[model samples]
Target: MSLEVKNLVKKYGDKTVVNDLSFTMDKPGVYALLGTNGAGKTTSIRSILGMLAFESGEILWNGGKLDTSKINVGYLAEERGLYPKYTLMDQLLYFAKLKGVSKEEAKKRIKDWAEKLQVTEYIYPPAVKGKKAKVKKAEELSKGNQQKIQLMAALISDPELLVLDEPLSGLDPVNADLFKNIIKEEVAKGKYIIMSSHQMATIEEFCEDLTIIDKGNVVLQGNLNEIKKSYGRVNLCVKVEGDIENLIKEADLTVVNKTPNEYQLKVNKEEDAKVLLEKILQTNLPLIKFELREPTLHEIFVEKVGNVHEE
Candidate 1:
């Protein structure tokens, strides 16, 4: 199934938050919606999911109007949406019921997800020998555990389309990896996912296609690999034991970052990198590492947004 957003526009009073934002998911995989804070990424997502109204635009699913009520869609919103005082099991079941899942099936899915997310202790408290078993409330869990519960709620119904906003935002490294693995599994199951996150590295890992918005306007949108190729491999990284400050000056390389461990430089062309390498070799410095590569997603995002601000 394909999901398409055409000329989506949303305004609040006199300000337009999302203007002519458009993108398409023609097949199953991850699609990234990216922007800086208040850049309209979340607005575009809410509009697509039919949770918020837009001024003028059409969100279509399989050539027809997109409606959440008719389709199996799951969403993990950026803002946590749990009843803080309610039991985790109760909330999961409620979310599942809203998605039309059977009570019996919902319990089974909850059990499985709890194990996968390592939240079984909260969802299914161990017997207290002589005391009553008690399930933990949403507020009792850590932020990361609460996030897992929210994700379980999103996946309980096995939705065909999933939308995750900052899915790994507050998790520790271990929990973040767990979430990433689950996302990979979902992709392997051929689920279509729309993800929005500030973590460019995570986007690079999962999303092949993406749209980068800036101040409600589309700044870059296309296949990630193609975008990187267009920029060329101008990023050069070098590591050595001795100082290469004067050598870098002679080669006219712009240092993007310099640390005790390495020198991150920017070169205009491949020839410039070769010249730098030659100079380093001539100095008989102990070269630990030298590599030339394309600009990463993080670099591209910064450049795009920075240019938009300048304009």
Candidate 2:
């Protein structure tokens, strides 16, 4: 099945928060939506999930209109949505029921997920030999563990379309790896996923296609590989023992970053970097390392959406 979002528009007051944003996923894979604060990334996602209204757009699932109420959809919102006082099992079952999962199936799914997410202790307390075991409340778990429970809720129904908004935001390194593995597993299961995260490295790890918005306009959208290829190998990194300031000045390269032993330069073309390499070789500057590569996702994002608010 395919998912399509065409000419989506969302406005508030006089400003358009999301202007004619569009993309499609014809198969199961990760699609990334990236932007700075208030750049309309969240707004656009809410519109796609039917959590918010839009002025104009066509969101199609398969060959018909897309409706979350009728479709099996899983969502992990940026903001945590569990009731602080409710028991973990209670919330997961409730969420699963809302998604039309049978009670028996929901219980099985919850048990499986708690073990997979390493939260079995919180969800299923072991029976004490002579004492009673109490159920765990949402407030009882740490932020990271609570995030895991919410993820369990999202996958309880085994949704065909999964939307994750900043799924790894507050996770530590270990939990982040755990979440990444789970995402990979979901992809292996052939699930369509839309991920939004400020972590450019994480986006690069999963998303094949992406849309980057800045001030409600799409600054970049395409296959990640193709986008990086288009920028060419303009980013150059050079490390030398002695001072090479004069060489850099003579070569007319823009120093993006620099340290005592290393310099990151932005060249206009491969020829410019080649010229700098020639200069370094001629001067015998004790070169330690030289790298010419395409711009990183982080670099590309900064270049396209400079000082813009992230949403």
Candidate 3:
């Protein structure tokens, strides 16, 4: 399934959450949606999922409006909603059934996912304190485990499209790795994924295309690498021994942050780096290190958000 959101708008009284947002994604690939808190990320997701009625917009499954009454879509919210009183297997099978999966198929898929996620041991609820919770009613598991259940709820049905919101919210590094590998495998199988996250490292590692919104407006969108390159205004930090200030100065770089012995140069036009490097070598400055680095996602975030915070 494909998603096409066009002219989306949402408001609460005087406050507009999503302002005429639009985007199109087809085929199987990971798409990351990023924005600061209260920047309409959630609103947009909700609108597309048919959870909220937008003032005016279009959400299409393939090329037409989404048939909320018929589309088989799965959603995993950041705030997970799992019955703590239900056994993991029972809960998952319930969701599977809701998605129209047969009992046999749901059972097989649940067992397969449990093993894949290394949570087969958690199939039965653990004892929290003194009382023993029955199979029909159990409430003992870690928050991370609950998140895993949420992931399974959204993924077990094997829907054509998966909408995961902060899917790794509670996972540690190891679990995060496992989750990413699973997401990758799903992608390889040609399942379209739309992920919302604040973790830039995760976004960098997992997503190919991304859309960044600020103040209810999209400031950047497209392939991650291409966006980084085209966004320009990138500063490359070079650490080489000796004085190459004159050469760097000759490069006429902007946003030049420097110390006596080290130099950080911002190349608005990256082509100038080549000319700058040639000048540095001519000066016989000890070229101990010469590298070009893209701006960190944090930097990009601040630029988009327009609020600098202490690092």
Candidate 4:
């Protein structure tokens, strides 16, 4: 089933958080919503999930009105949604039951997810001979572990639509890799996923299409590759045995970044890069590396948003 959101709007009295937000996911792949804090990314997501009241919008699933209560949808919110004092297993079972999973089946799914998410030790302690294991409370787990439990609750029902907001946030490197692999596996299963994160590299890994919002407005949206192609290959990277700053200045190139032996130059056109390359080749310097490429997503995002401070 596909997910579509059109002309979504949310206002806080006089302040508009999301304005005319629109996007569609017609296939089973990851679509990323990217933005800085207070950029309407989360508000648009909550509206699409029916978790927030919107002034105007159409959220549709499979050509019909979307209803999370009746649809098989899983959401991992950026904000933690678990009860602090409740036992981890109890809360997970409750969440699963709320989603219409049978009690026995919920237990089975929880057991499986515990192993897959590497949180089994926290959910179920090792049994002492002739004694029962103690169940851990949510407050007892570390922040990273708590996040994993929340993820387990979201996936216990194996939903068709999954929305993850900052899924890898606050996770250690090992746990981050674990989450990434799990997301990859879910995509392989042909699930429609809507992800929002600040990690540009992670978004680049999973999303082919993306929308970047700034201050309640969409600033950029499209297939990532096509968008990059439109910009053309304007980035140049080079390294040589000796200093080439004088040559770069002579060629009239803008240095985006520079190190002792490496330089990241910004060019207006591919021809500009070619001119720089010709200048460098004419010299007797040893060329260690020279490459021209398109701007990165992070660079595009910054260019679109201007100098606004991102939270």
Q: Each candidate's root-mean-square deviation in Å?
A: 1.0, 1.9, 4.2, 1.9
| Residue-level lDDT tens digits of model 4 in 1-311 | 78889899899999999989889999999999999888998888889999999999899999999999999999999987789999998899899999999999999999999999999999888878968887789999999999999999889999999999999999999999999999999999999999999998899999999999999988899999999999999999999998888988988899999999999999888888888778878887899998999889989988888755443
Clashing residue pairs in candidate 3 are: none
- In model 1, residue pairs whose N, Cα or C atoms come closer than 3 Å (at least 3 residues apart or on different chains), thus clashing, are none
Best by TM-score: 1
lDDT of 1 by residue, 67-163 (tens): 9999999999998879999999998999999999999999999999999999999999987987988879999988888899999999999999999
The C-alpha lDDT values of all candidates are 0.95, 0.94, 0.79, 0.91
Best by lDDT: 1
Lowest summed lDDT over 10 consecutive residues: which window, candidate 2?
A: 302-311
Error of 2 at 262 (Å): 1.2
**After best superposition, candidate 2 residue 174: deviation in angstroms?**
0.5
Checking candidate 2 for backbone clashes, the offending pairs are: 36-309, 36-310, 36-311, 37-309, 37-310, 37-311, 38-310, 38-311
TM-score for all models, in order of appearance = 0.98, 0.96, 0.83, 0.96
TM-score of 2: 0.96
- Can you write out model 2's per-residue Cα lDDT over 29-55, one digit (the tens) per residue? 999999988789889989999989999
Residue 268 displacement in candidate 2 (angstroms) = 1.3
